[model samples]
Target: MLKNKNIILGVCGSIAAYKSAFLVRLLVKAGANIKVILTPDGANFITPLTLATLSKNPVYTQYFDEETGVWSNHVELGLWADLILIAPISANTLAKLATGICDNLLTAVYLSAKCPVYVAPAMDLDMWKHETTQTNIHQIQSFGNLIIEPGDGELASGLYGAGRMAEPEEIISFLDHAIKHSMPLYGKKVMVTAGPTYEAIDPVRFIGNHSSGKMGFALADELARLGASVTLIAGPTAQKENQILTRIDILSAQEMLNACTSIFSEMDITIMCAAVADYRPKVIANQKIKKQADSLVLELEKTVDILATLGKSKKANQILVGFALETHDEENYAKGKLAQKNLDMVVLNSLNDKGAGFKSDTNKITIFNKALECTVFEMKSKTAVAKDICTAILKILK
Candidate 1:
């Protein structure tokens, strides 16, 4: 859930500030862009250089650097973050946050931030349990900030109590659960088919299209981002998903069909985006044919229409989508497929459109809904197109 997110990590004065380094590493490894903000007191426990190296971004220490004469814009830093996490938040910083004190850059950024703020408090047991501190915690929570409650363990005071900072792994898990729980497609099961199916004529030769699976892979990633549990059924392609998802690789249309049908009933949404072969060689040659003939002919048979079969068996609550790559009469063909195959929607693209069609990183598309209403989109990168498509799906669900 943290993938591609811009996060500002706040480290404050506390012995637990040492754990912030581990947290930064975990966030970076999870594909998040990290910016660390260290209070002057925090520097005493952990060096700013340590966090800067782990986060791969310059650490913000003060509002201005005396030597470099560079000013850090706290407002811009606050606005840039998707989330602000204050780990090892000392009692002093927590009180400052609750009371609107901006003595330091970290507190100033917190006050300027509009994104979600999560704080993990770490202090002595007596300080944590103090009535004033409890009041500040409540005040912070009332201002819509989340608190990752400290764990119970031995603290810097050498006394065991409930004042230890939560481990880095625990904090990551907490963030993921909090983010995903609020996503639009949270708990939705999605299936996406991608790439070009190959039909074998001989052991060494086969027929395939130019599909690179970029579109389908993009869709899978976007759906996953919306918190859906996605299963990607892909034909032979070198493409890879940006996020972790269940992937089943196949080499032929038949294999793709079998894979989809087996799980179609359980899916809330299914997108048939693969360029499946329409015909396959009727007879498989046991050995390579010698170059003895000037020409050759092979009988071909129609492959099963996987999308149509799924549409026929589709549940009332399921949303089935298909794709149409047309040379002429694009709208008519797409609408025909939308109705003929009982699809909820059909995405149309034409080879005539430059930067579109097979193997391109970009595409121009028109989406037709079950009501025959069409929405045309300008040429865009596959990733942006995926977001648009996913937004359309969300509208339908709404």
Candidate 2:
């Protein structure tokens, strides 16, 4: 994925600066065009000539050439690169970068760059744990820089703690993951259904499930994070999402169905996560029934199956995902529903799993495809589970 891509490696003044040489070698081996920029004090740890020899390019260290008196343009360097990486970022450098203090060419390029910036911090354990440093880290993230979290190990201070910079191989893996996640679903329209749909018995009474809408809302947020314009059709639930999703709130299963059907043609993908009631009162009482009878018996009828309806009419390019919440014969029931509905994928959750049911913040699921290929995941927070689902969906789309 890094082949022929422009990459800038920023080296700071720290003992971990020695690792930057390996970082440069790995990136070059992956067929990336490399530009090395060193802080003035950084050369004291590792020579610029050595990095220049490996990168096959001149190492940038100053604002101007000492021999020719020609000035170096940080703006041009910033615009030339597709990605900028600051490895072994010192505590002082991090604070300066976070505060927009550009005293060196690397910091100046950071201020001018339009591409994504990645930082790998290396400092003493005390400095890493400082409150002020933590605040500055948050500030840098708020400014849109991605932080590659430091690992815990023996620091340069000869103390074992959480201050070591990530190794070269792990850094490359992080970059690869980031590239895959960057606007992956751009230009795609998605619709997600969430919450338990109420089936009315009367004006005041209704039949509903214990769905809290956490799973569906999390899925919507994950899709939106991947650059999809998500339309969230929600049933009556006490859940709220902070992302700017196009949310349409409804009461009953039929209302939810109407909303989804109206937008079904425009969506590229649909995720049916809502726990909709299968039946409703055949005749709703205009008012609450008086408590005159010993028992109550009301006629019932089947409600519209939203997922099956979408599956039946889905276009060749449209992808439909169905969720199966099962109690008994979980795998067979989930597989049966997937094939019967003609869905592209089925996400199965069993009430048998302790933390995998409705109203909980966590879930465990197994995904099955038309080929009957399945992937089972351990119980995790709903956010993590949503990420798994999104990754699977993207693989199918590819």
Candidate 3:
């Protein structure tokens, strides 16, 4: 997707700077023509030679090359780029950018660049969570720079939190979306639901499914990359927030229905990706159910039909999508659900397909539109799955 694209990779001071080498290599391997700009502080972690070799372009470290006496013109570099990306952006550099301090060539070029600017911040947990850092992040956004949010994990400081930069593969995908602005779904609003609903059986015990939420999260990220404002209404899951989401948390099927009902009217599109339980326990136990009997029978009540309700109220400008996971007669069941729910499109996945279902990281989807036409995609990473779904949504929007 990055084939022959002009990219400026701005490296800032952070322990995560070492990952920039792999990032550069990945970008080059994907056919990007990359130029690297290293902050003086960043040189301490990774040498300019290492990155220059990987990117196949001379690294820019200063305003002028001391040996050649030729200046690195910030204006020209800025104009030359299709995209300006700052990976492992240190808190210090972020502050500098937020304040418009153009003391270095990179910052100067950033100020002059007409191309889109993307930031990937990396720092200690404390630094990342600090009010100052958050303010700087909002400032950068207000200036029109897209933030590729740091991931949560063990930091160099030995503290576990969200301070690590996104991996190279993720960044590459992000760049792909930024570069392709002509997608049909651009400037649309999309709503997605993902993960398993937890029906409260007690204060601790709850009825939940094995849903991983990967499909919905993928769809949300992909739609956002295509330039849509995505509101991801997610159920309980151990998922990380990505650069593409405006997330809303929910618990039981009732909550999921509530979340959908409140937001569906305003959306340009909605994809019901959640594995909401069809029924909920009629009686709530104040405490955990005791083992008084060898067998337990609990009454179950039907949960609200989020998809059908939305379909009934759907506006002419809005597009509604649904998902059908079947174990038998997959196509017949999926098509029936699609027609019954009034969905513009439906994605079907059978449990029989290994490595492509709940609790897994990958998926193989067959998309069915209102016309009953089908588009089948091979097994792909959730991120790639997102692109396909976004493509389908774009077709609907067009």
TM-score of 1: 0.93
lDDT of 1 by residue, 257-339 (tens): 99999999999999999999999999989887677989999899999999999999998999998999999998889999988
Ranking by lDDT: 1, 2, 3
Alpha carbon lDDT at 67, candidate 1 = 98
What TM-score against the true fold does each predicted structure earn? Answer: 0.93, 0.60, 0.61
**Deviation from truth (RMSD, Å), model 3:** 14.5
Q: Distance (Å) between predicted and true CA of 55, model 3?
A: 12
The true-versus-predicted C-alpha distance at residue 241 of model 1, in Å, is: 2.0
At residue 287, give the lDDT of candidate 1.
Answer: 88
- State the displacement of the C-alpha of residue 323, model 3, in Å, after optimal TM-score superposition: 0.6
Please write out the lDDT profile of model 3 over residues 61-116, one tens digit for every residue.
99988899999999999999988999989999999999999899889999989998
Residue pairs of candidate 2 with colliding backbone atoms = none
